[model samples]
Target: MTRLLVVDDSALMRRLLGELFTHAGGFEIAFARDGLDALRQLHEFQPDVVTLDVHMPKLDGLRCLDRIMVERPCPVVMVSAMTAEGAEATLEALSLGAVDFIAKPGGAISLKMDLFGPTLVEKVQAAARARLPKARRLAERLRLHRAEPRPRLRPPPMRPAPAAPVGLPDLPPLPALPGEIEGAVVVGCSTGGPPALDALLAPLPADFPWPILVAQHMPASFTGPLARRLDKLCALTVREVTHPVPLAPGHVYIARGEADLIVGRRPAGLMALPAPAQAEHRWHPSTDRLVTSAMEPVGARRLVGILMTGMGNDGAAAMTVLRQAGGRTIAEAEETAVVWGMPGELVRNGGAEFVVPLDGIAACLLDLVPAR
Candidate 1:
């Protein structure tokens, strides 16, 4: 049985979580009413995984999580609200080494159980199997995050590509034609995506000459804050694609949460547009969809696919296609990924041209895509 420690201040929530896990089976569970109690339980139970609530009495989630990472260094999943504040707090928790997170169901909690229970059970199971990231690499990433910005060259002018043809919709189900783009980068990540994204994008200079399109699995509320946070830290301009915006050098387009972001030719230039998530795709802002769509507008030769730190094989198949079609692909090394499912699949399928660690991914990208 997998040992699980459920930490929440609410008696009702604790009970509900207990019942949910009990029904799911395969778990030897223990409950803690607050962060202080959780700390005690952590020592006593020595659980394989912990589901920690962000808001708790005696000690808040962030502080308690900080201590837990230092002392025990086990996999911890954050249970957070789906509000703006909750999103920010949850992102912070992820940076502090939480493996993954699930949004707390609010309003008519009992009614939401059917939708919540399975996801909770799934995350806990994943957490139980997750590997603790190496502290040295994590420290290096944090150090880079706090490092001063590097000097940037002025970005050269982008040559104009003919706009999308008339009678075509702005957002198409599929990319119209193979664009003649100079070069572009498509990134896919989940699980420990945010912090990994930080380490990847922070090291690039402001004038790095490839447009980066990212498909990160997250809720609607979280992606916006994530973009804002990344924009603040990264030298590159990072924005969530809510509308049809032309892709340009030194810019990073974050796919809107719950929507798949695809690149399509428009009257202006190559634009990043959010399309409705395809049912065939299992994860939201599907990486496979994003990669395939980009492969259409931006051919395999001019494109680079990166798979990093996510659970499941979301980008493996598409990236394999990209590599076989003569595109470059990078997969994060298993030693660095919290859940190696995504990138590991790429390697297993013989897709990745480069298998690098989280600390070295930015350097790899820089080496692959030269500055203008």
Candidate 2:
């Protein structure tokens, strides 16, 4: 049985989550009232997974998570509200090392449990199986556990990439304006996507030759904050695709949450547009639809399909088609993935041309796309 620790400030929430997971079966459930209580039980219960609330009286969720990651790194799935504050906190939690999160529904939570319960249980189960990496440096670990933490969810300042190692080629600086669109890179990720995106995009130069389009599974309130956070961290310009935007070589377009991002041809040039999620697509900002639409406008050879850490097989079929049609495809290797469901499926389907770890994806892209 999977061991689960449900941490919340409210007694009602604790009881509801306990009942919900209990009904889901195959779970040994435990509860904690606040962050302090959660930390104590962390040792006693030794849970395989933890469902953490964002707000608590004595110690908030973020601080508790910091300690958990440094002391005993277990898979943690945050229980967040749907508000903007909740979105910001949850994103920080993901960055700090929590595997995934679920939005906490307001109102009589029990009444909404029929709809919400299944998703919560699903995330917890997935978190239980997630891989936690032990490769963090001692200093970085100390920073996270430091007594005086930085302001909550503060975005990292933008910084340029370090000099390339000897014998390695450095990325060419951004070319002069009026550079025509050559091709586009379409990326898809879900679970564990935020930090993975940081690792993938942070290493690229501000003047990367091709535009990057990202479809990360998230809600309407969360995507905007996520885009802003990423923009602050990376040298590249990143923004949500709220309207039809002309594709630019150096910018990164993030698909609006709860909608599908598709590519089409306009009189001016290739455009990334937001549209309602089609009934056929199982997930919003569907990666399959994104890749297929790009193929029509840009042609497969000009396109690159990058499938990263996520759950289920959302992009596997379309990326397979992309590879067969001469498009380059990259899958995040199983060794570094939190849950190898999405990228692993692509590999099994014979879609990916290169299987790389999380950190090497940027370099791999540089090698594939020419600066000239």
Candidate 3:
């Protein structure tokens, strides 16, 4: 049986989560009221997975997470509130070592329970089985039981490549005005996108002309924090787009899971459309949906499609359609991607016009957008 520890200060939350996992079967459950209690239980129960809450008293979730990675290094899923602050903290936990997370429903218990409870149980099971990497193991060992101080981690060496081909048969010719698109900028990324996007967005100047719509493959609860983290790192305003908001230039809108981030061009303007129904593709906030919607609004001239690091061909098919519609397309090159699945597929299928490394992506985008 999979062993799980549920760490939360709220009794109701603990009970609900514990019961849900119990009902799911194949799980041995334990409970902790806070990070301190969690540590105590960690020694005693030796759980395979931990569901951690970020806002606990005495020791916050991140502190406990550091301790866990250092001492035992089990898979952890952070439980966070739905607010922006909660999201920011949860992303920090992910960087520290937590595998994934779930958001606690807002005020509506029934609605929240219905949406989150079963998903939480499912993620717990997945986490229990996930393999911890060697890098993480080394980091844990250094943090937990240090005989000597560990050396600072050096950034990985950069690998350079020849300039990517500009014009290909299946792709449209490079636009004369590379950076001058009129409508929203739609991006689809997964797997290695977190760091890749950091590089791609870092060099963008403030006062960019269009809003960015991103469909990143991630768990439902993770988007809030991921957006906040990106907001701090990027020049433009970044936030998780809730329902009914129109897409506007100058903002970066990220899509949450359990839905597809669709774009609609109303008479008034472009809007961020969310559908909470079951994911039509294997990935949520699907690249296909995002690209299709962007095509509807901007047609060829205004749409920009970027496929970054990820597994599988989720974006390939949609990119073909986007190209056909005269939208500009770019893919992350293999040399810089953690996994080249999505970007590689786009290149193989003739869906991408330009393939650039992570560092070069921002410059390419700036070149593509028109000067204001």
* Per-prediction TM-score to the true structure, in the order listed: 0.89, 0.89, 0.63
Each candidate structure's count of clashing pairs: 3, 0, 13
Order of quality (TM-score): 2, 1, 3
Comparing 1 and 3 by lDDT, which wins? 1
- Put down candidate 2 lDDT per residue, 299-331, tens digits, no spaces: 887887899999899899999888777777888
> lDDT, candidate 1, residue 13?
83
lDDT of 2 at 91: 86
Model 2 compared with the native: what TM-score? 0.89
Off by over 4 Å in 1: 136-181
Error of 2 at 356 (Å): 0.4
Q: What does candidate 1's lDDT look like per residue over 142-172, in tens digits?
A: 6535744433222222211122122322221
Model 3 alpha-carbon miss at residue 327, Å:
5.7
* Model 3: how far residue 150 lies from native, Å: 24
